[model samples]
Target: MSARLRPTSLPWSVYEHLAMVVGLVSLAVICLAWLPLALALRPVLRGDIGQRLGRLAIMRGFQLYLQVLRGLCACRFDIEAIDALRDQGPMVIAANHPSLLDAVLITSRLPNAVCVMKAEVMENPLFGAGARMAGYVRNDPPLHMVLECRSALRHGAQVLIFPESTRTPGYPANPVNPLSRTAAIIAARAGVPVQTLIVEFSSPYLGKGWPLHRAPRLPLHCRVRLGRRFDPPRDPRAFTTELEAHLRAELAGPKTS
Candidate 1:
């Protein structure tokens, strides 16, 4: 029989701490460096040009951050599966959010993908400027969020959303949170397929309620695998049920390295 997977250990060695610092500083540098450019171009480059530039910048920045992690932080990521969706045309890219890095992992691969971010994060100075310029949808005032998602889909951009709406609660015990119907509703209204992606982490380092100041185990491993894609739903409520069940099943099945 296969052995049950255990949580990764948190080590507070000097190497581990230094790795964490490197990861955090590299990310901050990348985001801050792009902030000025993003802010400056926000008004001048409106519409598709702005979106393309913003999303591309975010993607490349994230890619560079991941490279830093891999090089100096002993992090391993298997996220190539996401690249397949880059040219899949307009679609709702739904995923099970396990950690804070889920969006960064997926978006780093798809330059044309726009995220569905929290209303507050969409206003934060650190990330808001670039996100706004990327034409990312803000998850507030439900009606407006759906309308914006549909518009982005119509523009042939993949809409990246976490159906759980936030990081999954109760980690190992609850593989996923009950999915919000937003993803289903968006896909239904946009007439786009819901492409599911399953994100797994070696440990719950940056999961819900995890502290930013806390250091994690070295050699953190993260993997993203493509999941089932459901056709545009005629009944969003039913689709949410099915999507939630499917995600739970996939996450519960097995652990892969």
Candidate 2:
């Protein structure tokens, strides 16, 4: 898709109300179908079958959401790294969080992406319902979450995480959350490299006061650029510092960031 040069604007309240309705309806549908589907087929499915089903459902749901956003609210996404994504393995996909739906956007585009979400999401009525079905790793303590992430990748799952921990309220150069050492720690223990994605969304409609129904007159643009992977140091503190410096470097030089 081509980049949208012109910027657009819409009332935040309208989008907010519309989003609430959509979310409620979507949640109801997910709950109604999910229970029956889980009971009827989980026992029948075996081995990679369950994984495949989970992957499909999650991807399909995410894609549908993107499509709806594009069609209804003028949101458009452009994903890069098509070539590198083909040669897949247990990858640690780490990214900066610019928007609330950044994780969902990544999931919609990547295959077999095992997401690391907060424990609260598992309890959230609307999101938890669908996320539980997708089998995302919970945001437990560092040790446990790391082990779970490693296991998922060892099983051919591509792991996606936001090292920034939370979305940036604005497009600031620095990350909002203190850079967590967890990502590097886990990668080093798993003996794997980390793939970096710098995600940016222009004309965001889903932020603090924004809504889903508010369509931007100008199209929204979001991009995920894949960066080279690197090995982590054995020492936890050193690994964390190196990863932080590397991420800062990637965000440096005005042309890219």
Candidate 3:
């Protein structure tokens, strides 16, 4: 019953220390690279090349950030079903928003991705300018945002969206509204399949109410599983239910338990 008795073995404290060192170090690196470009050049760039390069740079920067954070904390990640992302086309990349870093990870791994982020993230001093340069979407007028997502997909861009619309603080597992199906709608309209990702970290930093400075490091074990693609339902309600179900099932793996 004990972890030592089980096939897998590792000390709990080791995981914690690894998490702390990695998180802090990576956070520092992110501030150094992303903050500068986001603050300085992001405002000056425009058009496709600028946007594309910005997104790619920011995503890559964040990837390094997460990697160093996990390494320092002594946390590790194991990804499965990577082939699901191999086939390329305009895709609806939907995933559970567990941490602020989730989008960064997803974007870095996926090509031609335009994130569906909150309007505020576009205004935040830390993320706003870079997000705009990357041509990420804002959570604006419900119908209009959906339409814009449709347009982005039509233009041959893979659109990434957190169905929950915002970070899940209170009930991280459960969705907030469950009414909005913006991602699904866009997928259905474009006749593209939805690619679902379940991102789980052994212990996360930004999820819930933990303050940034006071946050404790837990082993930053991350499992990114890409689920089987499914067609968006014709009916809006059914589409939403199916999307949510896919995400939950992907994240609720017994192996994770």
Global Cα RMSD, each model: 4.0, 4.6, 4.4
- Highest lDDT, which number? 1
Please list the residue runs of candidate 2 whose C-alpha ends up more than 4 Å from where it truly belongs after superposition: 1-40, 43-47, 173-176, 204-218, 252-257
Candidate scoring better on lDDT of 2 and 3: 3
Candidate 2 lDDT at 201 equals: 62
Question: TM-score: which is higher, 1 or 3?
Answer: 1
Q: Which residue pairs collide, candidate 1?
A: none
Q: lDDT per prediction?
A: 0.89, 0.66, 0.68
lDDT of 1 by residue, 39-127 (tens): 89999999999999999999999999999999888789999999898878999999998889999999999999989999999998899
Q: Distance from true position, residue 81, model 3, in Å?
A: 4.3
List, residue by residue over 215-239, the lDDT tens digit for candidate 3.
Answer: 4445346667776677765776788
Give the residue spans of candidate 3 off by over 4 A. Answer: 1-25, 28-32, 35-45, 80-87, 169-179, 255-257
Candidate that would win on TM-score = 1
Provide the lowest-lDDT 10-residue window in model 1: 1-10
